[model samples]
Target chain A: DAGVTQSPTHLIKTRGQQVTLRCSPKSGHDTVCWYQQALGQGPQFIFQYYEEEERQRGNFPDRFSGHQFPNYSSELNVNALLLGDSALYLCASSLDLIQETQYFGPGTRLLVL
Target chain B: AQTVTQSQPEMSVQEAETVTLSCTYDTSENNYYLFWYKQPPSRQMILVIRQEAYKQQNATENRFSVNFQKAAKSFSLKISDSQLGDTAMYFCAFITFVGSQGNLIFGKGTKLSVKP
Candidate 1:
């Protein structure tokens, strides 16, 4: 079976620009979550989507948002990006909203100038 | 809020040797879950092992095992017969059961280097 997959392996953007990262969750999974991993640091949770609605969110600012399609694919959008936004964006998917175990994707690398 | 801490910033072990990575977490919830994820140079967060709070027995997967002291809020990962492939950054993560959909809180990570 296919595991979680993400698009746009790498992206380059300037401050104030917006970027969207895509994710295709693992087969048989329904919940999707986003995370940001800065250089030399572990991933920090962004938000989680279930039933096409955000069910839980981290301490991220409003500039970060996400969407989950019926097929369980997800998109992470960052607007008015800052230099700190340059990091690896990871996508994870679980079997359901209640399942705590999540399978993660390789992640998309974003560089903000 | 929950926090995961990995005390060792870097660790090294010779091939075929054993290494242990330490982790501690702070949480008020009685029921939760802990995990150890391995991220190689490719940067894929691969699940190494997981331990449920309520389960008294420690979790083990092949050569990887965890020493989970729930009462002390400590979780340490022990890698046996380490190989070159085991050289990577290992992160400890936690998630509480209070919020069914709560996301994982990861530690800063410990970089493990296996010398051949």
Candidate 2:
């Protein structure tokens, strides 16, 4: 079975630019969540998508948004990025909706230069 | 809001030895879940172990075990017979059981170095 997969292993962008990261949920999984991990720090939850709608969100600003397709794949879009936006964007997939164990992907590294 | 705390910023363990990473969380909810995730140099958040709040028995997976003290709101991860592969940043995470939304709150993380 294939685990969660993310695209654009690495990216470079400038301040005020926009970037979108993609993720394919693990087989048999339906829920997708996004997280941001800065260097030497733990990941901070961005948001979660279920049934093609955002069910939960963290303290992130409106610049951060996400979409979940019918196939359970997800995309995280960040607009008007700031220097702090440069971090590793991780995608996690869970089988259930009630805070079950989440399987994570390799993550896409974003660098705002 | 739930908050997880990992006091140890860095820890070192000799190969084949055991190391314990401490974590404490603050939550008002009676029911919740806790997790320990390991991130190696690859930066992938790998689930190491999980413990349900209602379960009195501690959760263990192979060489990884957790000491969950519900009264004290503490959850510590114990890695036995550590190996070079165990060297990584370990994060403690928490989530409440209030809703279908599974939002995880994570600690700063503890960097574990296994010396060969």
Candidate 3:
């Protein structure tokens, strides 16, 4: 069983540009969540999706959004990126929306210049 | 505010030695879940251990165990026989849900260095 996988291990974009990171949850998982980790800090929840609908969101702004597909894959899109948006974007998936153990991906390192 | 706190910013232990990382949490819910995740240089977040607040006995997974004090709202991780591979950033997290509004709250993390 392949674990969670993320695309474009590293990305570079200029300020005001839009970027989209992709994630494939572990096999047999249904829920996907996104998190942003700044340098020397822990990850903060961005949002969570299940059944192809966004179920919960964190304290992030409207610029950050996500979508979940029928196959359980998810995408995190950031609009009007800022230099401070340079951080590691991690995707985690669980069996459901409940408090289950979440499997995480290696994460996409976004560098906004 | 619901939060998790890791007071130690850094910790070190010699190979084969034991080390303890401290964590404290604040939450209004009586039943919740706690977790310890390890992030290495590769940037992959890995779950090391988990504990349920309703369980009285501490959870143990081989060399990793937790000392959970529900009354004090403390959850500390103890790593035994530390190895070089054990070096990583350890984060403590708390999760509580009312309906479907649950999200993990993670701490700043503690960098663990296992020396040779």
Give the runs in model 3 whose Cα sits over 4 Å from its true position: none
- lDDT of all predictions, in order shown? 0.95, 0.93, 0.95
- Local accuracy of candidate 1 as per-residue lDDT tens digits, A69-100: 98989999999999999999999999999898
Docking class of 3: high
- lDDT by residue (B62-83, candidate 2, tens digit) is 9999999999999999999999
Provide the DockQ value for model 3.
0.83
Candidate 2 residue-wise lDDT at A35: 93
Looking at every candidate separately, what fraction of the true A–B Cα contacts under 8 Å does it contain? 0.88, 0.85, 0.75
Q: How high is the lDDT of residue A24 in model 1?
A: 96
Q: How close is candidate 2 to the true structure, as a TM-score?
A: 0.97
Interface RMSD of each: 1.0, 1.2, 0.9
lDDT of 3 at A51: 94
Q: Weakest 10 consecutive residues, lDDT, candidate 3 chain A?
A: A94-103
Q: How do the residues A1-113 of candidate 3 rate in per-residue lDDT, one tens digit apiece?
A: 99999999999999999999999999989999999999999999999999999999998999999999889999999999999999999999998999468889999999999
Q: Report the C-alpha displacement of residue A22, candidate 3, in angstroms.
A: 0.3
Higher-TM-score candidate among 2 and 3?
3
